[model samples]
Target: MMSGLRRGPLASRFSPSRQAAMKQSVKLIVGNWKMNGLSAALAQAESIREAVGAAGQGHRVVLCPPATLIDRMRTALAGSGVAVGGQDCHEKPVGAFTGSVSAEMLADAGATVVILGHSERRAAFGETDAGVAAKVEAAIAAGLEPIVCVGETLEQREAGDAIAVVSAQVEASLPTGLSERDFAVAYEPVWAIGTGLTPTLEQIAEVHAAIRAAMVKRLGESARTAPILYGGSVKPENAADILATPEVGGALVGGASLKAEDFMPIVKAAA
Candidate 1:
């Protein structure tokens, strides 16, 4: 572990093996295609799968296309070691909510993972922390691993409240069910998504460390081994440096993940 990036003071109390496990969790490279991809995109998924053969053993690579492509992508990438996921899911298993995809629906469609509480969902749809927590519960219940997202806006960072804002989201957006289920926390700064702007490595490290501390406070040791992913303008050019950061266990990639040529390098960087 890096000098001061150990999980927390409580980490010392755990067995050495447990301490090692915290830092040794598999690196997760997730491609968030977000409202992008059509049938033709299946070829890109196949290319990614072909290139990823045996390369992601110590890590995991997941591709989350739009709801329209979940099952098709899952079928195309079946047994390729690349998991398919959904960009979002509704909090309920079944309801009258028209046009909303439920966690159960995602699971039934062959999606093994789901992204919830993304900054776009929060900003464009006004999703709240409590709402995200509910969706997390739904995801767990539906047997899908949840990638719960939390981040601050550019204005919040400029006001010197980035850490506090993210900490609160960590406290409220994740549910107790995650203590036993496989889940991940993604920190995607609102301003960076699709803007080609990214936080400096030092800034990314600081926020990631703060996120690890927050998770420890909320879930104790169970949270230590959970992956904390950094999202926002992540690309092959900077993937290695960002993934090498102390508390950053993986990346939730956006635009750069839309194509095999661009996404493969980022996956290899994680590997």
Candidate 2:
């Protein structure tokens, strides 16, 4: 005989049918801690772990702290089933470059992924696509997946050249042999990032589909399984709709990721 008790709403949410759909694959939710954090910020990771708990089993969670905190974040997430990454890395394996951390060093520090060509890196530091390409290749050489970011500015979008601009950046930033494995790409419009402006669902679909098409052209079958994440002002309220759009596999959350309360809902939305 079976017990007559019923399952709780939260427990019943991930039904066997739903679990099958989720499986080993999941929507990725990555937090770009970006130049922020000290040893104290490890608490944020703990809070995030608590908030996620077992409920986030259906989604992949990544936390990217500044280089200074990557090792610490890695340790904190050791048994939490979350992954830690770096905000940036150098193009060379090792060199005399001051204030630059090499991809090899990041890999040594337990960073499985690194973000390259972020808008801030481009606008503030003047990073060119060629330079981004070098960094991507270095990261790949060191066995770190590079989350290559590509998008256009508000002016470019207004001029209707957003697709052209991002396409060119993709071609220049991505290295050869992209079809070898499923890497990550994030599309974050410069003007939308942290600016509280989000592109419409139709707009997001158009850009993401275009990006996927470009990937297929460049990488063949491997492009089909690649995870393309959307960034720039992603919020819980809009996460579901945006993620449901074609080619949008997950998100690279910015301001919203700073708080567990704000970020968990987005994870649920993706799940």
Best by TM-score: 1
Tell me the TM-score of model 1.
0.92
Error of 2 at 88 (Å): 0.8
Candidate 2 per-residue lDDT, tens place, 26-136, comes to 677889988778898898889888777756455778888889888888888887767788888988888799999999999888788888999999999999999998998
lDDT of 1 by residue, 1-271 (tens): 0011244677768785676465556688899998888899999999999999946555788999999999899899887878988888888899899999999999999998899999998999999999999999999999888898999999999999999999999999988777745788999999899899999999898998898888878877667777889999999899999988878889999999899999988888877
- Residue 69, candidate 2: Cα error in Å is 0.7
| CA shift of 54, model 2, Å | 2.6
Weakest 10 consecutive residues of candidate 2 by summed lDDT? 1-10
Q: How many residue pairs clash in each candidate?
A: 0, 0
TM-score of each: 0.92, 0.89
* Candidate 2 global TM-score: 0.89
Candidate 2 residue runs with Cα over 4 Å from true position:
1-25
